[model samples]
Target: MDITAVNALPYEDFVNIFGNVVEKCPIITAAVWSRRPFVSLNALEAAISEFIDDLPESGKEGILRCHPDLAGRDLHSGTLTRESREEQARAGMDALSSGEASRMSRLNEEYKTRFGFPFVICARMNDKANILRQLTERCGNERAVERERGIEEVKKICRLRLQGLVLCDAPNKL
Candidate 1:
């Protein structure tokens, strides 16, 4: 949709269009809606980023918790959103060998146990092996540090999703 159409969309329509950008966090899209008439896709992104930056730690953790583990059960169980499934597949997550899958599952569990939240990365930006390596490395980070890193990863995922939703150069003329 064009930027003008985006700016004019009703709240429900806006949520339907962009809610999946942040997993199931419709609140993020809703908050961005309140700051509408985005001059460009960059403005829309800035609104979303500001909202995320201002969110309480609990809210940030809740958003992080909404994402599924990479190459994990959600992929096989059909629990992930279509966007997530496609992104994971693009990152070679769906083609992991049995051994690789098992290793990822273990690391996911370990990472969760250590950080109190699932490990998150912009899967579209990295292959499965690199994801696993980061998971292993991040598991050793201090809890607060890991939580902040997870939030940053979520921001990256959201930015990519928004790029898919918004026209990159269109001005909002509404």
Candidate 2:
């Protein structure tokens, strides 16, 4: 979509297009709709990042919690959002072997128990191997560090999703 068209979208249409850009957080899209006449796609994305950054710890954690676990039950049950389904497919999450899926499931549960939120990475940016590796490695992190890392990953996912929906000279992809 063109930035001009994006700026012209009614709030509902805008949300319809962008709502799940940050997984299940339509509130974020609703709030940012007021920041319209976005000068560039970058400014639009900045608004999203800024919104996420401004949240208190609990709110930030809430955003993370809304995300489905990579390769978890949502994917198995075909309950994932289209954006999530595509992102997971990009990371080859849809094709994990039974053994690999088993390991990922175990590590994901352990990480959530430790961190109080599911482990999140920009699946579009990393394949299954790296995702598994990071899940294993990041499971060792303290809560604060892991929380921030997950938020940053959320931003990366947001950027990519925005690029897909809004036409612009997207800045270098992360």
Candidate 3:
């Protein structure tokens, strides 16, 4: 839909439209719905970011934990959202050889064990090898640092999803 159409959607409709942008974090989209009539994709993204920034540590952790492991259980069980499935497939995750899939599964477990949440990344922005490399390297990061990085990656994913759903435009003059 275009920016104007997006701006005109009702509260629940708006929230539903964007609810999956950050995986299972519908609360973030619900919060953003109150700041409606977004004139540009950036405005919508900023509102979402502000809501996330204001969340308590527990709330942030809940959002992080909502994300699925890369090429993990959801993919095999066909439980991933259509957007997520497409994004992972684009990253060559769907075509992983047995060895690659096994390694990814191992890294996913290690990363989650270390960070207490799934390792989040903008899959559409990286190929499988690059994602695996980063996953391996990031597994060594401090928990706080990894948490922040995951949030940033979530933002990038949200931005790309929003761009797919809304057209960019200059802010409306009051």
Candidate 4:
């Protein structure tokens, strides 16, 4: 779809389509819709960034909490949302061996216990080995550092997702 179409979308329709760009945070999309007549994809992305950056500490944590753990129960039970499932699959998380799966579960639980939110990474940009490595390494980070890392990953995910919905470089975009 074109940026023009995206700009013209009804609030409900816009939310329905782009709602999960930030994992389960549709409210971001809803809020960003108010900044419409976006000049380009970059403008829309910047709007999302501004909203997220303005969030209080608790709100940032809330966004991280909305993400399902990678290769977690949701993935095994087929309960992940379509976008999440596909992203996890891209990281080969959908086919983890029993040992690998169990290890992931244990580490995920540990990470959540420490951080009050699940570990999150741009799975589309990483394979299982890299994700596992990141999960372990990030667990050692300070709370503030980790929170910013997770939020940055969320932004990367959102950028890719938005790229899929609207033309990235279309001129005269609404």
Candidate 5:
């Protein structure tokens, strides 16, 4: 899954590898997949940023939909991934007290009701407290702002995940 291998993949194969996430963040995924043998992690990250920068508002919304709800503990098919679930577990979702679970449930409902989508965050490097804190703070953002922010968060997550999966930060050419 290094950059050379990733870039060598057929476009359809690349799309399939990411599953539904590709459709949600096409421009970013496409640019990343198309950029072969990235010499540095920064170069790959640049591609991602450029892709996000060029997306239309509607397309940005599509990208935002790729992320799971912040700290979502329960499995609901289509949403579970090994990496995400592992991160959730690391965040202590498995040991939530009943009261904490209730609060999270209510907060999730309120956020979704207000924003028209679930609250999204890049939980890759975050533990449970970080996720919970973000969920609480984000509840205060205006809908329009949160929508835009959600897309950015997804972009961040994709970059981190892609770095771990594909980029190698080598200086040699592919």
Candidate 6:
């Protein structure tokens, strides 16, 4: 939406337009359109970056929930964007070996049991084997460490996604 149009929107409407991500991730959603207009895309990005930077460690999990579980073959909801799906398909993970498939299932169960959530990664650029390998290793980390690592990884992925969608002039960094 244009800045003028965005500025005119009510607070509730503004939050709704952003897909309710603000409730769960205030850092990424801190930009209030009514108070100020971002002069350029970079300005908008800078606002988002500042918010993400200021978020407390405890708030990271809430933000992570805003991302979809990577290669979540059975997922029917959440932010599994079409572009992410296509990228996984290209990386040859839309199909899985029987062993790899079984491993993913088991890992999913173990991961959920430990974390109370499915393992989430931005699997845009990783191939099947590499993704599986990483998942296997991550499954063994202590809960606190894994949680921190997961948030950092998700932030990296989000930056890459924004680079692709919002920052056309810049190269994708992740």
- For candidate 2, write residues 92-130 as lDDT tens digits: 999999999999999999999999999999999998899
Task: State how far residue 82 of model 1 sits from its true place (Å).
Answer: 0.9
**Which model, 3 or 5, shows the larger lDDT?**
3
Q: Which regions of candidate 6 are displaced past 4 Å?
A: 1-46, 73-79, 167-174
Q: Give the per-residue lDDT digits (tens) of candidate 5, residues 51-151.
A: 77687876666666665664454443436666666656666766677787778778988898887777777666676677777888999999889888887
Error of 3 at 114 (Å): 1.0
What TM-score, to 2 decimals, does candidate 2 have?
Answer: 0.94
Q: What lDDT does the true structure give each of the candidates?
A: 0.86, 0.92, 0.86, 0.91, 0.65, 0.59
Candidate achieving higher TM-score, 2 or 5? 2
Over 4 Å off, model 4? 168-174
What TM-scores do the predictions have? 0.93, 0.94, 0.92, 0.94, 0.74, 0.65
lDDT tens per residue, model 3, 12-113: 898777888888888789878888888877788999988888888777778889888889999989998888899999999888999999999999999988
Worst 10 residues of 3 by lDDT: 165-174
What does each candidate score in C-alpha RMSD? 2.4, 2.6, 3.0, 2.2, 3.8, 5.0
Off by over 4 Å in 3: 168-174
Clashing pairs in 2: none
Stretches of candidate 2 off by over 4 Å are 168-174
Cα displacement (Å) at residue 121, model 3: 0.6
What TM-score would you give candidate 5 relative to the actual structure? Answer: 0.74
User: 112, model 4: CA deviation in Å?
Assistant: 0.5
